[model samples]
Target: MKVDLFTLVLIVFALGVCVTLVDVGTLFSTAEATVTDETEITSARE
Candidate 1:
C-alpha cells in the first residue's frame, strides 16, 4: 500500500491542531489556579 501526500498533510494538520488545543486548555487552568491562590494570600494578610 502507498500513501499519498495530501493524506499525510491532512493527518499532520489534525495532530497539530489537537496539540495546540490541549496546550491552551492547560495554560488556562494554570492561570485560573494562580489567580485564586493570589486572592487567598492577599485576603489572608488583611
Candidate 2:
C-alpha cells in the first residue's frame, strides 16, 4: 500500500471538508449537545 504526495493531500483535504460539514451540522442541529460539542462549535467560530 503506497500513496503519493498529491493523493495524501487530497485525502487530508477531503477529511477537512468532512470535519467542517460535521461542525456546521452540529451548529444547525436542534438536539441537545454535550459540553464537548458545544466547546467545539465555540472554538470553530473563533
Candidate 3:
C-alpha cells in the first residue's frame, strides 16, 4: 500500500467540491419552489 499526502488531499478536495455543488443545487431548487408557491398564492388572491 503506497499513498502520498497529495493523493489524499486531492481525494478530500474532490469530495468537498461534490458536496458543495449538491448543497447549492438543493438551495436553488428550494428557492424556486418557494417562488412558485408565492406566485400561486398571488394568483389565488386575485
Candidate 4:
C-alpha cells in the first residue's frame, strides 16, 4: 500500500511538471509573436 501511494504521488508530480512546461512554451510563443509584429510595424514606417 505504501508503494502504491508513492507511485501515485510521482505520477501527479510528473503531470504538474508537464502542464508547467506547456504553459511556459505558450508564453514564449506569444512573446515571440508580439516582437515580430512590432518589428514589422517599425520596418513599415521606415
Q: Which candidate leads in TM-score?
A: 3
RMSD of 1: 0.8
TM-score of each: 0.90, 0.58, 0.93, 0.83
The residue-by-residue lDDT of candidate 1 on 1-46, one tens digit each, is 8889999999999999999999999999999999999999999999
Error of 2 at 2 (Å): 2.8
Candidate 1 Cα outliers beyond 4 Å, as residue runs: none
Give the per-residue Cα lDDT of candidate 4 at 10.
96
Using lDDT as the measure, the top candidate is 3
TM-score of 2: 0.58
Q: Report the poorest 10 consecutive residues by lDDT, candidate 1.
A: 1-10
Mind giving the per-residue lDDT tens digits that candidate 2 earns over 1-46?
Answer: 8899999999999999999999988876644467668889999999
Q: lDDT of all the models against the reference?
A: 0.99, 0.87, 0.99, 0.97
lDDT of 3 at 9: 97
lDDT of 2 at 38: 88
Write one digit per residue (lDDT tens) for candidate 4, span 1-46: 3579889999999999999999999999999999999999999999
lDDT of candidate model 4 versus the reference: 0.97
Measured over all alpha carbons after superposition, the RMSD of each candidate to the real structure, in angstroms, is 0.8, 11.1, 0.6, 2.1
lDDT of 2 at 1: 86
Worst 10 residues of 2 by lDDT: 27-36
> Which residue segments of model 3 deviate by more than 4 Å?
none
